[model samples]
Target: MNKRMTGVMAAGAAVITLCASSALAAAGRESSADMRGVSVLVGGGVEGYTRGLGADIQPGAAYGATVILRPTKVVGLELGYAGASNNFDRSNVAVSEATRGPDVMRNGGQAVATLGLTASPVQPYLLAGLGISRYNVRATAAGFQDDTVGNVPLGGGLRVHLGHFTADARINYNVLVDQQLATDLPSTSATSSTGGIYTGTVNLGSTF
Candidate 1:
């Protein structure tokens, strides 16, 4: 395991610990105008990016859930899980030239805090959070084992609420961990990755 992964896991544990304590205290209170009491979010979206020798990178669909604990009417803490896989087509490569480039899969968790502007028909909101992503890349080239990478995402999104359900769109930029990409491959060297780590997602969920 890489040290970056260890740090990510540690941060996730800390978020869980803090949210657990908050959830317990919030549970004793009744749902009111100022608080949601409890909510569960379920949604899916696309992810796109590439590294090394892939020109056409396929977008991957991801599904995840977020459990929310509302301490105040407008403030909430959420923990979420998301995962996806991507495959890219490679051309004009010396070593893996005969074969397609690689297929990659990533899984990770996020911790966020949401501030609801208004909990009404049009509930626009803002979210800020820290995310940890673990990615495994496998190339078709022989002697190239799967590469595991980790990254942190920082960004926000907008949400609109309707009754028990809500729709939202968010954009986040991923900062890949340095050590993960510093390693080299046989045919190619991991210099820098192309495409923006920026990801856009649309989601829907219900409050319980």
Candidate 2:
């Protein structure tokens, strides 16, 4: 695995560790409020790489896990890890080209503030989060380093609770954050990648 993939895995592992630690900490609490409990969910789904990396990447396999801490009936804290693998190939041979581009992956982590709409078995919630993404790119292309960019995820989802099990469907629109001009593939001067990542996935989980 390359550094990009390593970084992605590291970030994801870190999030999982944090979640475990938080759950342990919460386990010692004496709160009787179910709304103030800790919950962990594991699931996998497909993601659409609608506009990632200059806009054109196609949909790919996406899967992730998340941990939630609800402090109140209407508010919660969530940390998640999402990863998608795609066949990444782009070229601008007229000026420059990414000759070794293919099968590049995208990995990301998110920290969001979740607001629940109701306390019923069927609930809807909105989530807004800040996330960082690492792209696994081909290194043969000079001056083309794998990008680690920040992004904002804005979306909401619906959740159905039955007993201790839950099912969820969410769609998030990723707005790739802007950055200063960094590099030029053909060593002309500099350029920036302005695009976005969008995803829609379903998850199945249970509360403990």
Can you tell me which runs of candidate 1 are displaced by over 4 Å? 1-35, 50-57, 92-102, 117-121, 141-150, 179-196
* Candidate 2 ranges with C-alpha deviation above 4 Å: 1-36, 50-55, 89-102, 138-144, 179-193
Score candidate 1 by lDDT.
0.54
Candidate 2 lDDT by residue in tens digits, 110-196 = 999888887654567899988888877543433345677677889987665554555566777777665321244222112223445
User: Against the unseen true structure, what C-alpha lDDT does each candidate score?
Assistant: 0.54, 0.60
Q: Per-residue lDDT for 156-178 in model 1, tens only? A: 65554434554556656655544
TM-score of each: 0.61, 0.66
Worst ten in a row by lDDT for model 1 = 182-191
Which one is best on lDDT? 2
Q: Residue 146's C-alpha lDDT in candidate 2?
A: 68
Pick by TM-score: which candidate is best? 2
Deviation from native of the Cα of residue 116 in model 1, angstroms:
3.7
